[model samples]
Target: MKKKLLNQPTFLLGTIITSIMLLMTFIGFFYTPYDPTQMDNSNKLAGCSLEHIMGCDNFGRDIFSRVLQGMGNTFLIAVATVTIGVVCGILLGAFTGYFGGWIDEVIMRIIDVIFAFPSILLALVFVSIFGTGKYNVVFALGIAFIPSFARIVRSEFIKYKDMDYVKSARLAGVSDLRIMFVHILPNTMTVLLSSIMIGFNNAVLSEAGMSYLGIGVQPPDASLGSMLSEAQSYLFSAPNYAIFPGVMIILLVLGFSLMADGLKSR
Candidate 1:
């Protein structure tokens, strides 16, 4: 498997990008060139130099440091939201697909309603009700993500639930749980894994959108979206401020997208 992945250029590139971003985020936990939030009026708006690698923000904080922190925060939120979607979605989809009765009808109807709405729009609604915070963003996006995951998982399960191996297991007196999870779920991993990468991409974008709107992560905290939002006013004076974070977001989305494509193709 590792050898196969090495031969896939798309997968190799995606893995490299994702791995670098994760490593940078991890490093932010223990070290940074400067305090990400520290204000230095004297150094504010200064261009990149030996002292400040990416230069100073309007408040004179280290842009590079904040970026590292922002990367970590954005990644954490994405993971949390995706995890919620995956766990809930798998359970709902698996059971409904395997059983296929009145319960499937009712649950699927609800998922359909959610699926009809735009994920960002539904997330906006939940954020409004729950109020603004990292956790709230996670909750809103997580809920919004459930429908897509459930729909995918359900289709996969329905397709495989009655396969020959599943029937053999059933005849062996295997419990329904074992049949679904042990026998069938493994068969769905390739598709599920591909979807998971796509899900992470969506989560990253959604969180950035929320933060850009001033309702996510909040001020004094660094998020790529919030940073871009805050830097808009200085577009001419400090174009790099926006450019740096914008690039990070692009790299992030591109990395996951490539990964998903690679997984699907492989």
Candidate 2:
């Protein structure tokens, strides 16, 4: 099963793309052709050349460097957001599903209330209230994404709570915590893993949208969304400024989407 999964076409393709993006992000820590934020008015809007492989933006900052740096920021926010969502969702879902009765009803009702608002809208509200920054955006998106993961996890836990293995663990004097964490959690992960990937994709998109709207990672730090936002004015004059960042966003989302699909197929 593991070998087949590793060999799956979609999985392999997604892995390759994701790996390349990660490599670019890692490389940004050490080197880029030029400083992404350094502006050289003399070279403004220059076309791709040996010196500037991806060309220069209107501010004359190297597009390649900005894109690489943006990749790192996007990855960080998305990973952090998904981590918060998954952890909180799993804990709440496990407790509610295992305990059942009033606890389930109350927790699920709360989740439903959160679900009433669209994720983006909810995130926007959070950003508006907490103000803007990378961590703020992560927190906002993480809270917004919790309901979806909670519902998925709740269903999975409910499905397994009464299963033979779980019952066996219960009968064998295993504590509820142990059964839920040690046994049920592992089984639930197969499905949860796919959801996690999808959530990560959504998180990246959400962060980009928030940043584009001016509530995400602020200036001095680059993000694909912020780059696109800044380049909007120079679209006709220097299309490469927007083009590279747009492509990076699409590729990043595509990689996660494909990986989710592959994991689901497993």
Candidate 3:
């Protein structure tokens, strides 16, 4: 399995990219060349120099520092969003699928209604209603993700629950919870992992979009989306301002997407 995974170019490349991004994020939480928020009036929009690896923004803040910080924020939000979605999704899907009946019908109906709208759109509405901030974005996107995760887990559960091995386990007095989680869940990891990668990618883009609309991360804090939003006005004056964040977003999304592709290929 290890050798096969390593043999995949998509997995190798995606692993490299995401590993680098993760390293940058981990480092950004500790050290940076300049305060991401620090502004130097005379140094505003300065071109890249040894002292400012990526140059300075309109506010004279180090674009490198802000870029690092933006990556951190985006990653943090994605992690939080996936955490919520996975926990809730797994539970809901496990229960509904293992014990099917009116309860399954009711829950599935509710899921259908939620699925009618895009997760980000649902998140957008939630952010609009709850007011904008990082946690709010996490919450909105997290809940919006539940339906998809649940559906995936549910399908897997339904398929695995009736297998001869499951019947033997049931006859042997294994708890339903154990059967669902211990025996069946691991089998679903192949598909679930791919979905997780896609979910992380979606979270990044959704957060970026919400922040671009100026309703997501807010000022003083740097986020890729918010940085992209801030960079828009300076496109002509400082094209690199937009370019840097745009590139990071692309890399981030691409890394996860490629990772998903690789996982699916396996």
Winning model by TM-score: 1
Residue-by-residue lDDT tens digits, candidate 2, 216-241? 88987899999999999989988888
Q: What's model 1's lDDT at 176?
A: 99
| Candidate 1 minimal-lDDT segment of 10 residues | 2-11
Weakest ten-residue segment in model 2 by summed lDDT: 123-132
lDDT (C-alpha) at residue 52 in model 2: 87
Clashes of 3: 0
1 or 3, greater by TM-score: 1
- For candidate 1, lDDT tens digit of each residue in 43-97? 8888888998788899999999999989888999999999999999999999999
lDDT of 3 at 202: 87
Clashing pairs in 1: none
For model 3, the stretches where C-alpha displacement exceeds 4 angstroms are: none
Please give the lDDT score at residue 139 for candidate 3.
Answer: 94
Error of 2 at 248 (Å): 0.8
What does the lDDT come to for candidate 1? 0.91
TM-score of 3: 0.97
Superposition error at 152 for model 2 (Å)? 0.8
lDDT of 3 by residue, 1-266 (tens): 97888689999999999899889989999999899999999888888789987888999999999999999998999999998999999999999999999999999999889989987788778977999899999999898889999999999999999999999999999998999999889999999999999999988998898888887788999999999999888888888888898899999999889989999988
Alpha-carbon local distance difference test for all models: 0.91, 0.89, 0.91
Clashing pairs in 2: none
